[model samples]
Target: MECTCDYILKTQPDWEEHYENCKVKWIAREKRDYPKNNDGTLRLRNKHLLKLDYDVLYHLGLDTKTHDLQAMFGDVKFVCMGGTKYRMKETAKHMANILDIQCDFKNIVKQGHRYALYKVGPVLCLSHGMGVPSMTIALEEILKLLHYAKAKDPIILRLGTSGGIGVTPGAVVISSSALNDTLEMCYKLAILGEEKKFPCNFDKRLNQELLSVADSEDFETHLGVTLCANDFYRGEARTDGAFCDYTEADKQTYLQKLLQLGVKNMEMEATAFAHFTSAAGVRAADVCVTLLDRLLGDQVTPEKEVLTEWQKRPAKIVGNYILKYYNK
Candidate 1:
């Protein structure tokens, strides 16, 4: 049963006292509705969060009371995200072909213009634009959506492109951990007038699974630390930006320092993506194809056909893994 306090609180003068009196009943109802894992434990951090009177995923065009989330997404087993809407749309089509799911993929989010989302059987595909802030907002809403839907232990994966540090172009780089520009494996954010640091960690078990799949397919894959920057130009130490105050020699030195620290690639969204997923107790992994070798040059120079084929590499491996998991 849904709690009634939320509706009453909007017009009631003394909602706090009402909540205090109804807290036990609400918590009990929550406990009874939520599903459990194999070991009889909830996978999400706050198991009863969505069971409260009012819960909303505003950015996702969804809310607990407005939609029946459990019926809509309770079967979702995998969630994939990238930087562009078109790419993820293609991915959804590809996933449908692999899984043999015949449903026509459609955009379920109509009210919000922030992101695009699609569903095919047990898989959910979404696009999280280009930076840390954009990725973070999408993730927060998705997590809440899953919570409200009572989705089971689902695996989340980020499939995208990055600039290689020492590896060759077109090679896949699976992030062992995401590091900031300072070479720290933590994300910094100012919360409540104070700075807080959260570890940028990935799922080691998932990485191994992806590596195994790549090896079986004979694909070139590298596992190393990834550097998450805030911008494409200055944040990445590139000299090609419109405004540059650094020299070529300075850029070379910085890239060399990152290579020493074991960073294999650079991108803009991994830090927040890894940090938030880990905090939410969701298993996550980042698999990106290298588009350019930063040590060789600052500009990306590859043929359209070559780039298109390279872009499909990460999806191939990730899609295979998801298929195998479901078949098992």
Candidate 2:
């Protein structure tokens, strides 16, 4: 019978695999009351293991770039934003069929969304959606995957559904800036003050890339401000009568104030994305398809199809824009 070391060697032929195997071995050795180095390379129990320096894990798959691209746009990466878990899975399978990409619908996870990595040209398109949490999680996963793949300054373009603030429904808005008002939570936590702000900057190159795509597609794209709030209903104050502690007159006044501020749409995750990724120095921006007209008193109920045919107009524009940018 082969020893664990030999077993790992037989199974993994790459550096990443070797590294992972050695890491596990180091941990196991430590649990056996053996001494180890701070970096987990040298071992007091057996200096022989030290010679196994080649990282099998790193080579176990492809290079970091290849892995990233595979994860980003492999046969299983494009995902839908905002819907029931079952619905998201069904939608993902359907999209894969439409895009002629391989898909796995059984991997549905948190908030009920499915993910697929699509291989398009030389770039990989990492996409997922179907509700705020799922969408946010999908973005987080993509970032982590990119980081693991050691991608250098990869661009992120979010194509999701959003509520029109002052703009007309069905309009496609290319978000030049995503303003996060949810940072108020940090203030509430007493970690900072209400005036303290943390905003993420979008990548200028990628933004221009998207704009060029929009122009080529002939879609009406607007570069406007988008507000990211924690709560959808209360954040936008869309609740029926008594939306907030304010009166009807106050609510109307607030709407007018927001419009004056030039907020074109409202969503839940963009701000968080900006705050987290900006801190990490990633170039990211959001492009959303306006599904509901918030100012027109149109509520985005669950009964609405996750992605209506009309919504496809904006999605197509955004998708093509992303494809063109990455292709370049």
Candidate 3:
């Protein structure tokens, strides 16, 4: 099953014509390359990609051969993603100030018109939109972009807002692990009409490092499991949805059980987010600030000013970590 073309191509000058039609497989299916660059950066496992002359990162409006990914993002160390364009832009600005970068920041992904990407010194702060589906689209392209860029051991963080369990509003949560709404500690993914499960988790030492950074900051940080719900309402046991059969008492009971199980917050993307980055051999973490406490209520009833300030907590903690990394 191995390729016969290697010797032919090396030994013959006229092998180009037969190379395209060469029946020999050049890559081994059982043994994969270490999945890391010599400098310890991430590498993708898809073998067909080796033959492609070029790779188009359509969503990011960049490509392998067309754009100089290594030059543009070679220094990138942190890839921070969130739920909205404004938040990521704000994060870019904040990160820039932290890294002492002085310049006009533009959306690097504006051409794609799907996601907002801003390069803040060594940080790639971008918006992943809402839920797993949107995040997945952005994640794939960005991972490929980084792979091409040859960024070393990129720390991918999903910084966003979530609903807390027993914690108060404005509290920040560092996800120790991700769980589905059904309380499964796995990301249920559908592949070719078949459903499969992958362990839903994040980097443990990174979580501790973030927590260590949080201790130096003035924010309430809790480390616990995050319930990645599928919907904004029914999937999260919210009674205020357009349609809901569950009563308020039932919702409260379920939330209490989640609280007892050490779930500190509820979000929509961590399950698959952790899986994607972990599978790519990258260290990742999810840090979110609570908009409201689900144990107390359902709706995010905080004032806009308060919620806006609360939204920035995760960034503040993550920023400190970035600074620590830089200083170290």
Candidate 4:
């Protein structure tokens, strides 16, 4: 069967070779007959050797019987946020309940790979948790859904938690630009390296709205560079010398360098979202609540209570901004 993965693998020499080498290992896993579902049904299975076309899978959502992706969100506006399941689920539920809209969680591809789509008014709130890979997948899926639904004048918002880079803990950082450190690595790894530079641009109007809301709420919001790191724990250092595994001096030096680059916060997904949305000419912005002051050697864990409180301030600011902007 023709699949998007196949096309990508065949066209990219390095990827083709990598896939060829990995094919045997994939074959050892249990094979499930795909196309097993009727022409329109969406099936979920974990088979390694299935030839699934991403484009085909994406389009399947348009076929209502096959996948109810559209039905998932009615006429409500959509917003996207990021966090662990606990944090996201609770926050999404709160938003949905408050907004009086239906919100549902869908698994994007793997464990810890999930997104909550909440619709209220003319906005749709979509959020996910995981690192860069999951964020990329969610963005792709969201784009496909928006395209299939013929959604126009749609504005995408990213609400999530991040570590304070040069800023103080508890200070909210609204990303004006996401500096993609991983894109350079990915391009360099390519056999035929492309000279394309990912443009760092965001929706100007949306940014203004965020700033206005922040100002009105008297919240400290910084508009600067945000680094999207692939390895969160490894990339971020901890003051506690625990899971992050970085020495205090090392962490300070790294933070200083990042701050020199104008990075105010560090997170896992915004870079890719910014890159993709900018390329697609979509309106997108990310508002991240600072959970830890990495520059000051504060450790951030996925503690429920801490995250709950951390999310409330940013969510309130972003949520109010969205309501005011869209409502006006």
Candidate 5:
């Protein structure tokens, strides 16, 4: 019998054989103690959800009573999220090409009136908007849809663009862990006027898998903690915002503080995305391509065309991973 060490999956040229050969699972942790149905699907903690006859996923424009969720999303393996409708739509087209689904793909959630949703074979792509709050709502709705659909072992990936810390522009960042504004490795949100927190941690094996596949691309990929702020300006210590109270020195100090703490990039939605997905028992990764190095400046000085090109870095790396993993 081959050793079931996680390294075998990363080191072997024929990783799928080793992945199957290994008795241990690397991701989608076996939460045997958690509530599960006879069919072995993990149940949500919200008992009210299970009791309800139907769930209306308002943001995703999906409802159990309206659409056959099991038929729409049950076969979904990957949930890929980006920042815009256009980006995710393009991603759907990209994945469709990769999956050899030759057709003029349509936005499945255009009727939703909020976010854009598209499906390419086993991949589900969506635009998560800008910040944690925006991203959280979309996440909750989609997660609920997945739960109602009884999707099996879905892997979520947030493909986004961020401001790199000490790293160079166009480098893709794979967050080993996510952090909030106060530097905690957790996500904080208000529930019932009080507060609650969920871990922003990620599976190291998934990070390794992304990093390994990144070698197949010409772009650089870095692994480190990610700072998930509520805003792109003040929260990220940028002077470019409308209201700037702090000096450039203060901003430098703060960003340097992040660098010392191993934060490779800063984004708006990582903590919420990491926490919510983890809470739902879905394995997720925050992989963002840096638009600019904050250590150099606060502004993204690249041209629109260049920025667009940089934004595709994560998709390419992730697309490569999907191809390699799915083939085997």
Candidate 6:
């Protein structure tokens, strides 16, 4: 009989073997005391998940049966997501330095095809690709992963770039709430041949914490509503697509209407991102730096260096918030 210490699964063959080997241990945890909040609560919506002997996070190439979820991810307190793999990897390293924690953190996903994920101490930085569908897929797996890991009260942050409405480029905007293209604060999803609506509310206190951090900095930051579009062109009222029926004047009018409704910026993924987190009883926030003022232009034409620095602003503020929360 092999000891449990030598049973870590790493390959396809070993993964299957380890699954069979860990049945006893996995089943044993069910009888033991599960971690919970002070009030004995679990944030995950799937309340009956503990009945399962094992679970696999396919896209992430990790399994609760093979890997020690409690040992691997129990310490995770923050999960930051962005649009690109490169940006997220950078954010992970940047966070490591900010927290003064040294880690030669490598991409944990063996196949880097789906999404890039890095774990630095208590933070899990992930690239969610783009748009609602992409974010939704990742969120589904991530929620299960956190649930299996028994992570306590983890706060998720979507740190990305967006086109500004009335604000200047390079300014940061912390989302007050996420609104869909219909100007409704609900995430509509087709489930079992029916359209279901989920409220897309964000954390007000998290917004204020990010805002307080912003106030201490020299750069500009605003707390306002974010319009989450399904597409970058027509869905966001842009005239620079491959085909556009609307004229530039029409685009201006649409943008003006959004501005009048208090929308500060436009992005592609906040609808599902905000709704799913809220549905799971976890606090989520979207902090985006304006890449370009849509009222001024349609294209993001900032210099490379300027764009890089602008992209890092939200991550810095988020890191500061995490540091402050831990220090206090």
Q: Which candidate wins on lDDT?
A: 3
Q: Is candidate 1 or candidate 5 better by TM-score?
A: 5
- Alpha-carbon RMSD to native, per candidate: 11.6, 14.3, 11.2, 13.2, 3.9, 11.8
Model 5's alpha-carbon lDDT is 0.80
Q: How far does residue 210 in candidate 5 sit from its true spot (Å)?
A: 0.8
Q: Which stretches of candidate 2 lie over 4 Å from their true place?
A: 1-138, 182-197, 216-219, 241-244, 301-307, 325-328
lDDT of 4 by residue, 1-328 (tens): 2221111111222222222112232234325333112222222323431444433333122333455555554332444556555555555555655556674534333332244544444555455557776667667666656644545434567777888876767789888777665423221112356556555556544565566668766557888778877665665554553365656788788778878878888887776777666444355688888887776656566577766776777667666755554445
TM-score of each: 0.85, 0.59, 0.89, 0.68, 0.90, 0.86
lDDT of each: 0.80, 0.49, 0.83, 0.57, 0.80, 0.80
Error of 2 at 109 (Å): 6.6
Identify the leading candidate in terms of TM-score.
5
lDDT of 5 by residue, 1-328 (tens): 2233323134645334333212344233444333334343446767788778888888777788989998988888789999899999888888888778764567888778889888888899999889987888998888777777787667789999999999989999999898899999999988899999877787666777888889978888999999998888899999999999999999999989999999999999988887777666566788999999998898889999998888888888778878876777
Candidate 6 lDDT by residue in tens digits, 55-128: 77888888877888878888888899998989998899899988888887688865636888899998999998
Q: Which has the higher TM-score value, candidate number 2 or candidate number 4?
A: 4
3: Cα error in model 3, Å:
34
Supply the global lDDT for candidate 3.
Answer: 0.83
Q: Which regions of candidate 1 are displaced past 4 Å?
A: 1-52
10 residues in a row with least lDDT, candidate 4? 1-10
**Cα lDDT for residue 184, model 3?**
94
Give the poorly placed runs of model 6, Cα more than 4 Å off.
1-44, 47-53
- Candidate order by decreasing TM-score: 5, 3, 6, 1, 4, 2
Backbone clash count, each prediction separately: 0, 37, 0, 16, 0, 0
Native-referenced Cα lDDT, model 6: 0.80
- Give the candidates in order of lDDT, highest first: 3, 5, 1, 6, 4, 2
